[model samples]
Target: MSAWIRMIADEDADDTLQEVLNLARTPHGTVDNVMRVHSLRPSTMKGHVILYRAALHDDANTIPMWLQETISAYVSILNDCDYSLANHWKNAAHLIGDEDRAARIGRALHDRDPAAVFEGAELALMRYAEKLTVNPGQMEESDVTALREAGLDDGQILEANQIVGYFNYVNRLLNGLGVSTAGDVVGYYAKAEG
Candidate 1:
């Protein structure tokens, strides 16, 4: 089992909760329903909210948000976490500026690749993230070299690994804890699809 966020009213939340949820609202129009559903999990929610923001907003990574989202979505898919799979796939579609790549990655992660992924960092990120998620210990220098050849740097490799690793950890936690996504956030994202 894992720890899960509990729902709360605005006044009861700590400063970090208020700030993080408020910030999420500004961009996404409201704190994500997944986040809201787990509001009382102050520490977990705070850490997750911050991690997601970093995943998308990091300045050091040469990769674009879409590419990062692709990595997120792909790993989420492998881990079978419904939590971020769909939302991140669509988000990646928006970030990457190409519907096809997003759709392709989504499908590829689901083992339903229509043909082959075209454009962007599909092959490299997928191979690397998959290797990391499926077998972190098994990763070799060749894997790192392949990712570098595909345009990732040392930091990017680390970031990708960390992102994939943490999400998997969180996904398992959520599953074991019986945590569910916040409906409002899901609906918001569903509607935001434009």
Candidate 2:
């Protein structure tokens, strides 16, 4: 599906926008549809890329990258975001080193019961992601307490919140804008399988 807004083509991009596009390219040598959709507002796209990298990739955070991807995948599933779900589930499977296990986790998360696939702190974190995604207004201190009890300190909980919030925002943005998954993103998962 085409986006509601026009994406700036590479050849037509201005110098600043070209730099942003260059930075937005995935390792597979293509920019994501999410980034391209944001080309209408280059600065927002730049800020989004920066925030996404920091939230998910900053080495200072103790949260494992695989877990982050799992949280993102869970959130996307809960939100019914096909684009993000496919992208993150692929990443999660790659990180966990077993596509079957990741697929099982995805199925469990889709059923709103990841207990079948996770345990202890991981389960706690998944529950937190669910509450934060489904009913942010109902969140209580007890929610934070659950994470703490599961061995996540304040910093790690904060990181988890940021990741969940970011994915929710992006999912809504893409879904609201009718942003279809890019061809390369589909190819990303296909390449992973082979």
Candidate 3:
């Protein structure tokens, strides 16, 4: 799968683009197609890297890292963005460290059956993400009330909201740009925090 627009390869990047590309690179020294798509505008590329790290990898997020990745994967599934789905699911699985559990969760999310893998407040959060992804205009204040009722504090709810929102934004960006995982390092860019 190739991008609809031309992507500057690492070898062909100007000095500034090369620096920005470095920020987006995985441990394997390869860049994901999603980030590579921003190569034409290095500022966007830099902004993407910063936004991505803050959204999901920041130390301040209260939710577990694995669950955050799960939220990202769930959003990807809801949006039908295979590029995001594949990348995020792999990150979730790696963060989980249990192949069977991660696979089951992946199956349930892919099936759009959140109840199969999540319960209680987690399930409520998943439901919120689904609604926000599929029916943003219909979202009511009761949605936040439900998360609060399910034991999520405002900060936690905000984190979930941002994760969902971020994925929705990137999913559209990747899909609209025709970005695919081909020639990209899967899950290598994931910043795992303890």
Candidate 4:
């Protein structure tokens, strides 16, 4: 599909976005198509890239990368945002590389209890993110309490919420704008048969 969004370089964004694009380009290759479409609106894209970097490489009491990926994939499943789900599951595999954990995550995607400890708690964060993503108006104190019970401090919970909410925005923009993937990432993931 033709991407419905175009990168418009008015003045400074051309430089800034180029730099960010360079950073995204690595052995992993170019940023995903979702990022490409979103970067057409440079300001939003840069901010998101910045926040995502922080969320993954947190400066505070960081959530474990494995746990974060678990949450990310679960949230992607709930949102049905294909790129997020695809990338994050691979990320989880890379970080943990445990077949049992991946299986638990697969089960959790369907709202089944994860066979791993803390897996269900991670899913709770994801499901809560789904609620906040699609229905911010209904967010209540109880949701925060549930997250707290799952062991998120207020800051961590807020950060996760922000990440979830931000990705929801990205998901909407990317999907509606007809973004695909960086190259053949989806196909590669499918072919991995993991």
Query: Which tens-of-lDDT digit does each residue in 1-194 have in candidate 1?
Result: 12354466567768877876675562546565555655766666677777765765678666666667777777778788777675777667776666776566567668834236743345777777787887888989998888788776888877777777767776676566555654444522355434
Better of 3 and 4 by lDDT: 3
Pairwise TM-score winner, candidates 2 and 4: 2
The digit string of per-residue lDDT tens for model 2 on 97-145 reads: 8878877887898899999988989999999999999999999999999
Of the two candidates 1 and 2, the one with more favorable lDDT, higher being better, is 2
Query: Comparing 1 and 4 by lDDT, which wins?
Result: 1
- Name the best candidate (by lDDT): 3
- Output the lDDT of residue 22, model 2: 92
Q: Backbone clashes per model, in order?
A: 4, 0, 0, 0
What lDDT does model 3 reach? 0.89
Task: Give candidate 3 misplaced runs (Cα > 4 Å).
Answer: 189-194
lDDT of each: 0.67, 0.87, 0.89, 0.65
Per-candidate TM-scores read 0.75, 0.92, 0.92, 0.74
* lDDT score, candidate 4, position 17: 78
Regions of candidate 4 where Cα sits further than 4 Å from its true position: 6-17, 26-29, 111-120, 182-194
- Give the least accurate 10-residue stretch of model 1, judged by summed lDDT: 184-193
Model 2 misplaced regions, further than 4 Å = 187-194
Report the number of the highest-TM-score candidate: 2
C-alpha lDDT (0 to 100) for residue 27 of candidate 1 = 55
Q: Where's the lowest-lDDT run of ten residues in candidate 2?
A: 185-194
